[model samples]
Target: MAHFPVNHPARPLYRVLSGLIGLYILVFGVYGVAETWGDGLFSREDTSALGLRTNLAFSLVSVIFGAFLIIGASRRGNLGHYMNLTAGAVFLVTGILMMSVLQTQVNILNFSMATVIVSLLFGLILLATGLYDKVGTEEHAEEERRRREHPIAEAHR
Candidate 1:
């Protein structure tokens, strides 16, 4: 049998960061569901995170999001880029909404001051991670160097 080489300079960082985010969201959602046993997905009850007031719907969304991120990060595609970008934008908007008076009208995630802060911070991080690949040509040059250096191993394989 033979195996092909997969040279992705950004994959390591992408997997690490996305995996962490996925784990966090998945665990948070699972805990939320556990705390709200019989309640429906769209329940108005608070999440397991005390005083957060975020509902079950948000928890479900979190679970889905986490799963997607894991899948995206595990594969060699543009999933990470899109997922991070989308999540960053959405969370940023959610934070902005939390800070605004419309929070009550769309209290999907129990937009509090702390939530706003955390959301903004995470959003920025994701945004940065998503855009990391495009910042410079250094990564590309490094990848090329690795490829050239390992040509012998690749041929022997």
Candidate 2:
């Protein structure tokens, strides 16, 4: 089983970072929507917003995802942890998939290299935050610390 830190000391910092990323995505989506309003939903035009290429469809999706991240970051329980993990995986997979079709007609999102980079970066950050932001009682934390410190002993049990 995967072991995530419980009661991490830097949980607040991670939360703040994820929140900032969410805010940026939200703002970018709004701007992208305005910039591509008259275009086709999946237009292949070279519309740009916040240094990332986008289309109406992509902008709408971004709005939804950004809101999700914001809500997840605000949660004070394991809900946030699970949400962050899910979001991170989505972002990473999306980035890779988009990058694969960067110059092909399959690029429905009209993703540019910069957009792919940002997606991957956000994914990594969110994944890190999720891994260390688990909430648990002191006893759970102590057990985790002990397990981490004595992996050999733990494996034999």
Candidate 3:
């Protein structure tokens, strides 16, 4: 089984980081929407927002995802853990998928290389945050620490 740290010492920092990312995404989406208001949903016209290429469809999706991440970061339980994990996976998959269609007509998100890079980066950060942000009691944390330090002994028990 995967061992995610419980009651991690740096949980607050991770939460803050996630929240900041959410804020950036939200702002970027709003800016993108403003810049591409009259464009088609999947407009192929070169439109950039906050150093990332975007279209109406992508901007709307970003708004939704950014809000979801912000809500997840504010949660104080395992819901945040699960939300972060899901968001991370979605970002990673979206990055890879968009990269694959970068030069094709199917690039509906208008993703530039920079946009793909940001998506992958955010995915990794969120994944790490989820792995270490599990909320638990001190006793659970102690047991997790002990198991990590003495895997063989723990497995034998």
TM-score of each: 0.67, 0.92, 0.94
Candidate 1 residues lying further than 4 Å off, grouped into runs, are 1-11, 40-46, 50-53, 101-105, 134-157
TM-score, model 3 to reference = 0.94
Candidates by TM-score, descending order: 3, 2, 1
Candidate 3 scores a C-alpha RMSD against the true structure in Å of 1.4
Q: Residue-wise lDDT of candidate 1 within 27-131, one digit each (tens)?
A: 766676667667775565545553444556766777787787677566555566667778878878877876884346556554557767867886787776666
Give one digit per residue, the lDDT tens place, for model 3 in 1-157: 9878899889999999888988899999999999999999999899999999999999999999889989999999988889888988999999999999999999999999999999999999998898888999889989988998999999999
- Best model per TM-score: 3
List ranges where model 3 is wrong by over 4 Å: 149-156
Model 1 pairs whose backbones collide: none
Q: Give the alpha carbon lDDT tens digit for every residue of 1-157 in model 2.
A: 9878899889999989888889899999999999999999999999999899999999999999899999999999999899889999999999999999999999999999999999999999999988988999999989888888999999999
Clashes of 2: 0
Extract clashing residue pairs from model 3. Answer: none
lDDT of each: 0.65, 0.93, 0.93
Off by over 4 Å in 2: 146-157
TM-score of 2: 0.92
